[model samples]
Target: MVNISSCECMPWYVGVFRIRQRLTEEHWFDANCKYYTHVFDKTIISQVLGAIKYLSTIPKYEKCAKWLNENKQNLSQYFLEGFKSSKPLEVLIHGDCWTNNLLFKYNSKNTPVDLRLVDLQVSRLASPGSDINYFVYTSLTGDTRSKYFHDLLEAYYQSFSKVLILSRRKLPFTFKELEDDVERTKIVGLVIGLLAIPGIFFEGEDEIFDFGEMTEENMEEIFH
Candidate 1:
């Protein structure tokens, strides 16, 4: 068996865009309309749609109820639409950016030296937020997220901007634009978090799962 020591791990989402730019410019693949589609199953989409609709009916989500009720019918499509973007800004992203797909190596002083990402099979060309949302929402705790969210975003923007400069391409959008896109497409993470947090974290393996577990109490306690 191979033994690997745990290390600090943070995703470099900019590398994904950099690599895709190189591949497309070099004519490795048709970058026009061709992109990785079908990141998740229709059944999963249906389930999350159902969950969102259920959330709307709860008293806790009353503020969101208006929007959810208005959009539940098309919630699945909206979730999928979050994966798309203009060709200039689009790139291959590790669609599944959750913890299991990542590993890191550390120096003797416990500083992270390298990050290794596995499970490239689900990678796709999409908006930058596709990977960002997945990694941030899934990996970070509530306190850590609140504390470092701004700094983390700034770091990503700097790295991505540097890559764009190296590629000799004009920055397609400003840092604020990226921030707005993340906020707009946040539903993707919201849906995934809804399913992942309650199902995977709270429910024990031997326990029977219940739909009711997707409650405000559970979400606030577990997610926050």
Candidate 2:
């Protein structure tokens, strides 16, 4: 379980970033353009579609495959809609919020005292939910995620609220509104998990394989 007080730093810092994003940029790049044309895009929708196509062929995840196929377009629309909402709750997201991106400094008693976030390569302006999705989904096991989902969200909200109060700015939305924003963009977690979880099992070394040297048989082995 995540202790609210210990983890308060995260949401408070996130709120600070959110305020910074609002003050500096009135608008972000178009979501569709970012999704499709950006060089480092690694388009989530496309990857999820590919994963769905591949996973559908396997028997165990047939239902997931079917849902992916049925909702693929809807999923894209949800992302686009999140971008289009009249009053978007936008923020500067850490982009890569997984455990590896955080460096912790511990106190004499070995309790965590401070944390520094590294890797700003993917930072962007987007819904706060996008950051939340990346952080929570990547860091927690599925069972823990399911069990403490609301508690985690509440912890974040409390910290965010405190930050807003300190900054002398009223929170733009209530906790209920935050919940709605999260629900609206829940597909981000789903698509990200589908595309990324497989890589977690890739237990190879850091050595790079030269695909240029591969023959047809090698290609088959690589794919399999």
Candidate 3:
């Protein structure tokens, strides 16, 4: 993690960014936090993109062309070994995510103030969908759930992919490689398999999944 000094450009955002930079799920936090934190902080959406941008900038992906001159050691291929589906970006991801694991508390005025991501037991280098699919699965719909889900994820993907445009000339993979990532979900049951964990289906009133949403379109949009 970069020092707070690095974020001097934006002081108010310092605490949020510093915490995210220093904390990797690799080292366990104190047990005081019971939920497994997969992510932390209300990362500025732009800053999240900034972190991914750093990855794309570190090495040129075009080295794949020369075969011998490749900067990365066929790194994407190594990561793909475990997956039966295609990939997009060969990027690092939160790996584990779902609404239940994310902890958010609004301030006194009911404004969002803190975000503590929990459950990193499975964080890994995987498709961005690894994170996105989880949210799609776990996020609760209010009377207007689908509207938010589609809007938020598309906003995420658009911002996430912006950095790659600069890497266009050196991109190692083909259009098909990227498209395959989104297409893989078209196969039945995959997204659900990733999201339908036992923890999310807890029994009893304390475990109720209800969020009191109304509107058939909202429900339909979530599953659609």
Winning model by lDDT: 2
lDDT (tens digit, per residue) of candidate 2 on 50-153: 78878978889998888877776566555445433334476667767766677767778867666777897767677777678767776677776786779878
Predicted candidate 3 versus true structure: per-residue lDDT over 1-224, tens digit per residue:
11122212222222132223223424223322422111111111222233334445657743433332231232222223322323334444444554555565566775555456577565544454444444444454333334354455444444433444443523335545544554453221222332254334557676533525524445433322
Cα lDDT tens digits, model 1, 1-224, are 01212212342544534466456432213223322122233334445555667777778786675665566555556666776777665666777777667666778897666677788766666777767777667767766666676777777777777777887877777888778778777877766665565545545665534544555345434322
lDDT of residue 201 for candidate 3 = 53
Model 2 segments beyond 4 Å from truth?
Answer: 1-9, 34-61, 72-88, 205-224
In candidate 1, which residue pairs get closer than 3 Å at backbone N, Cα or C atoms, i.e. clash?
none
Cα lDDT listed for each candidate? 0.60, 0.65, 0.38
Per-residue lDDT for 207 in model 3? 51
> If the candidates were sorted by their TM-score against the true structure, best first, what order would they fall in?
2, 1, 3
Cα lDDT over the full model 2? 0.65
Question: What does the lDDT read for residue 92 in candidate 3?
Answer: 45
Residue-pair clashes per prediction, in order, are: 0, 0, 7
- True lDDT of residue 183, candidate 1: 79
